[model samples]
Target: QYNCEKRQEVKHISARIINGNEALPKHWPWVVAIYDSNDTLVCGGALIHEEYVITAAHCFVNQDAHEFSVLLGTTLRTNSSQCNNTPKDCNIQKKTTRKTEVPSKEDEEYHKASETQVICVGVESICTPIQNTCCLFMKDIAVVKLKTKVNYTDYIQPIGLPKNCEDPPASSTSYSVGWGRIFEYYD
Candidate 1:
């Protein structure tokens, strides 16, 4: 079940959302990083349940369960300093692999067990409506089941889903979050 407290609003010069800015550990705790075997951030996911993640269906194209690991409790993609600064219950799973990616050789202290264990037990994609003409995209969502249950922390928890499938208010400020490619490099 969900077990995270509300994020405290802090006054800052930057806008509410911005690129390249490091996210606060407590803010949007349900947002998780989906990584590949080499520790590369492939996509971003939202924890909907202890053993379930909701992400873009395109991220799973040609990807396998064994090639992915979900990382939580940390904001830095490859570093665990954020977790190290947290209180108790900071544990990770340690497993050896052929060529795992470590943030840096000198930062061996952060080289701990992969904190999150994730496996795509099953994937359910939202079916698109049939169209006569070329269709770009439709219902581009998928739900992934985690093989191992996750230990909920202040940095890792599930988000509240709407009870009914209704469109949001037109003037609502929705957010798009991810650790994928950033606009900084595009220019």
Candidate 2:
């Protein structure tokens, strides 16, 4: 069974930060990196269930399901090599310990003795919300089905969802974390 309540606390001071700081290992365990057929990082998603991920519909607007894959259990955005050449060739391995690569000297201090068990899986299908054609951003969410069910671990888990269709308190604060372009024309 999957546990959705298994999440680490996230602290945010302001509504937005110019460039966010690096998160701690396993801090956002449900986060996954979405890659294109060329194994290039396209977007970031969250594991909502054992076999499902929630990402933006715009990320796959005209893309095929076979052209995408999800990488789980790593903090490095450039960890596509861990997925091997293709998603089909990637297999779920037993818990194995391996040192996570730290790209820069600054990141080394944040990831001392860090380890990660990366899993790469192909997308079986994508489910998008039905909406009018007038607006492109309307109902821009998508649910992606994974080719294989993920085995949960300390570094891999599902995120919790709201039980009722109720709005959050007016005083509530929310935070979003992902790897993406800093500005519209940056990347």
Candidate 3:
């Protein structure tokens, strides 16, 4: 028997994250920490499918697909304590990037230049940004492909995507999360 209907619900009320807080284990299982080749935490992403992760396109700027890694099953971005209990290894199999044509000459030129400079996941297919418009200034979304099929666990899982084009009710709650320093500006 499955307990999906009566599980403890952990959710967010808005899309903005104010001061960082400790997330509980198995609470936000889809959340992941994106890292560069140097093992530096560069951004945050959510697992939306067994082989797909959604994150910001800006996160891959000046970065190569081979130089990226993702960490799951943990709350602290820089620590591996959560995965120590398990012996199985988790690996990222692939990454995908969708190119969108921006509106400004300056912005468009910059994006084109950057695309030439950095090689993102292979261009097997192209799609627009998650927003209704493909403007980079406002729409900064990307979907990354993982090479291996994800094995769901107590700390790692996939999130559900919207089924229709309609917007959510204004009363609905949304949550946004990321990995970063506690203070954005320090004197």
Which candidate achieves the best lDDT against the true structure? 2
User: TM-score for every candidate vs. truth?
Assistant: 0.61, 0.77, 0.62
lDDT of 2 at 113: 38
Flag the better candidate by TM-score, 2 or 3. Answer: 2
Evaluate candidate 3 by giving its C-alpha RMSD to the native, one decimal. Answer: 14.4
Q: Write the per-residue lDDT of candidate 2 for residues 1-187, one digit (tens) a residue.
A: 5456545544333345445555655677899988877766788999988999999898898778877878887767654556433446333222233433344675575444344467788898999977668686878899999998988876788887777967768896666778743334455
Model 2: how far residue 39 lies from native, Å: 1.1
Error of 2 at 116 (Å): 3.6
Candidate 1: C-alpha RMSD to true structure equals: 7.7
**What are the runs in model 2 whose C-alpha is more than 4 Å off?**
1-3, 9-15, 84-115, 181-187
Worst 10 residues of 2 by lDDT: 89-98
Worst ten in a row by lDDT for model 1? 117-126
Cα deviation of 101, candidate 3, in Å: 40
Ranking by TM-score: 2, 3, 1
Candidate 3 lDDT tens digits, 4-72: 222224532333454544444455667777665454557888877766788888777555665665666
Error of 2 at 165 (Å): 2.4
Best by TM-score: 2
Q: How many clashes in candidate 3?
A: 4
Q: What is the lDDT of candidate 3?
A: 0.52
